[model samples]
Target chain A: MSEFWSDYTVRVVVFGSALIGAVSGALGCYAYLRRQSLIGDVVAHSSLLGIVSAFWGAFLLTGSGNKSLWVIIPGAIVAGLAALLLTRAVTGLTRIKEDAGLGVMLAIFFGTGMMLLRWLQRAQPPIPGRSSLDGYLFGMSAAMTSQDLWMIGLIGAAAVITMLLFWSRLKILTFDPEYAAGLGLPVRRLELLLLCLMVIGIVVGLQIAGVVLMISLLVAPAAAARQWTHHLGKMVGLASTIGAICAAGGALLSAVFSHLPTGPVIVALVTLAFVASVLCSPSRGLLFRRRFVVD
Target chain B: MDIAIETQQLTVAYGAQPALWNVNVEIPSLGITGIIGPNGAGKSTLLKAILGNVPRLSGHVTLHRTDEAGSAAIGYVPQRSAVDWDFPTTVFDLVMMGTYGRLRWFQRPGKREREQTRQALQQVHMEEFADRQIGELSGGQQQRVFLARAFVQRASIYLMDEPFAGVDAKTENMLIEILHQLRDEGNTIVLVHHDLTTVKDYFDHVVLLNRKLVACGTTPQTFTAENIELAYGVAGKQLLSRIS
Candidate 1:
């Protein structure tokens, strides 16, 4: 217990997770408003392919198999954006709807990523950071370094700043896209900006929560916050706060219990918050609405 | 009479099917103009084409007031069902959005804008609901809120799509009064209206449409049984009989 409190690695991991949680949660509000929650899941899953591709590329370029965050983050962003574009193209060009397009993209990209990871394992000599590659699936926060924390902080700051700067435009775009376009706003460009932010948020979460559980970090906090407030500004603020708390708490609980994995623990905490919000939030909550019966 | 809007062979399509075909019409300035048609008659499509909301297959719409800033000359009230009512926003905040077009990028609504929003809400009799969440309002109140938003824009030309649909009698009367006030103040108001009975009473000028222009003239001159029949097919004769 004393060692856990003093360990710098634990401190870095917790901070990194908190930053990842806050950024994803805040950006997730727009996705939720746009009814594109599944897009977050799609982006997270597709980023796995990006990670493996980055590793392979690094191996090919340097003749050394080092999993650098520099290469991995950019690769994840590219893959996430590509997946989004593919989904858009499928929906726009074909008769398929957006949900079906998202489903197709999610399955194909994740399946391809898994195949690439397995092939990399069998095809190459034991890479230096190859063992930790599995960590990107389920996450290994215990192994996060100060460098990971810096990367998370940089990406998180960028996302938050961009959201603040374009707050009104994004709000209008999310709530009434057609009206925004009619008002002479560059609706397509604003949408692209939001998608880029979502991709960046997902990329930042990859090392902390991993592909499988990252969507929960992106969506759950916003969902929970939405129950408590009807104002978008308040919703974004509350979601960021909730996300930071949940991530830090989960990291601490996982630290206390060595058997519990950090990623799943964080996801469980977020789920609990969402459930509580659904059951107990005022005005809109199931229990409150039933008790009050006010329309 | 000055022409506020002129469409020159305006054609719009949804995929291969044309929504509006070769719509050539002139909307007079400084009065209430009704775009009356049946369902799927391109009434709404005409307004959208004028506003550049839909892609034009051919031709163009020219606004007479070329000196006005981009989109600032027009205020649009979309259909009630166009936006999600359950969106998380207050009445005041939504109304402030009307001022966005006049503002520079990254500039938020300020004191003057707030005052205008307040005045617009007052005009719609929605001042009391300023703080209320949009979803909490009744359907009539929601419609009034959208009107307030459009009013705050203060555009010279107003285009409304089914603004009276689903509203209470009181809201309808209030909206009609406001429209009369705007018209008297020399603003051009065009509405996509379905009720043929109110066309004569509500508007001075009318455009009868059925995917193409059936008639465009003063209401008394254009709102005739023959043109109504042309726009609404055989059923319009019966409707006209009922109206007369």
Candidate 2:
């Protein structure tokens, strides 16, 4: 146990996961308020396509099979942004609602990604490090290197700093976009900036929780924090704290158990927090409301 | 009379269907103007069009500003149903949003803005509820909160959508008093009002609309039975009789 605590890899995994959690949780407050909670999932899932595409493209161009994080991160960003724009276009140009558009994109992008991954596996000249692509799906905290941690920290800090700097405009944008427009705010530009931040948050989170479980990291902490606070700033702060704690705890537990995957464990912890918050929060909780009958 | 807002052959549409068509009207400055129309008569659409909330299919709207260096020339109170009141924010924070227009990007509200917000809340009799969550307010209180938000903008022109839709008598009276006070201070107040009963009592000028401008004149001249009938059909006469 002491050796586990002293191990450098375990320390990096824990710190990296916690940083990803805090960033995603804070940004998730806006997603939750905008009722676009599924957007994170959409971006995360679509990033898989970016990962596989970057791997294939890099190999084809350089005649090398080495899967570089540098190549994959940009690819994921491009794919995530593409998915976001396509979803917006589908919703804006057609009668299809935003939710339905997101669902369609999620399925198409994820399906194409899965097929590409399968083809890569079956290719005659097998990619040497093709298995690393799977890490972007379910995450491998145990395999995280110093380079991956630095990338995660850099992206996470950028997302959190941008959010803090534009806090007021973003708050109004999330609350009432029409009113924001009336005030002569650059509503479209502000919205695009927010989606760009979400893309950053989701991309960074993809390394720790992976695509399938990343949405939980984005949503659960914010959902739990919301039940406890009636102020947006406080809610966001609380969500970050909750996210960091859950991520660190999950990382430690997974490190100790050896058999438990860190991503699912972190997701489960956040879900538990959400349930506890919903049931026990002072003003809005089910138990409190049931007992006190706040009108 | 000085015209505060002028729309020239303004047309707005929702997809293929036109909401406001070839509407030309000038709102007089320093008066309470009531925009009265039947359901689906584009009353709210006219206000939205003027505020640039909705896309104008063609034509233009011009706000004649007496002062060039004000925070914002226009303040808007959207329909109560248009907002999610359950959003996590205090009444104070919501009102402070009015000051955001004047603030530069990334600039937080400071002492002056906070003071203005407090005064605005006091003006609307919502000072006590400033710290309360928006969702905790009654329907009338929520409307008052929105009004305070608009009030804090200190804009020369105020556009409100259905300020008296579902409020209690007390809140209605409070809102009417504030509107009168604002008008007396030489601010133009345009309200998309549904109640014909309060037109004579509430507005100095009335813009009667039915997809287009039916009448735009003083309440006595524009709120006539003939124009009301044109705007609201035969039921307009019945409503006028009941109100008169």
**How close to the true structure is residue B93 of candidate 2, measured as C-alpha lDDT?**
99
Candidate 1 colliding pairs: none
- Report the lDDT tens digits of candidate 2 across residue range B29-98: 9799999899998999998888787889899999886434553447889899988888999999999998
Instruction: Please name the candidate that would achieve the greatest DockQ relative to the true structure.
Output: 2
Docking class of 2: medium
Over the stretch B1-244, how does candidate 1's per-residue lDDT look in tens digits? 9998999999998866899999899999878999998899998899888877788989999988532574544778889898887788998999888888777877888899999999999898889989988887877888888888878877788889999998878888989999999999888899999888888899999999999899999998999888988999889989988887
Q: Give the TM-score of candidate 2.
A: 0.95
Q: Is model 1 an incorrect, acceptable, medium or high docking prediction? A: medium
Worst 10 residues of 1 chain A by lDDT: A286-295
- DockQ agreement of candidate 1 with the native complex: 0.52
lDDT of 2 by residue, A1-295 (tens): 8888799989988887888789888988888888877888899899899989998999999888755556777888999889989998998788898889999999998889989998998888777878667777776677777788887788788888989899999999999887787777888899999998888877777766788888888889999999999999999999999998998888788888988877888888999999999999988888878543233
How well does model 2 score by local distance difference test? 0.86
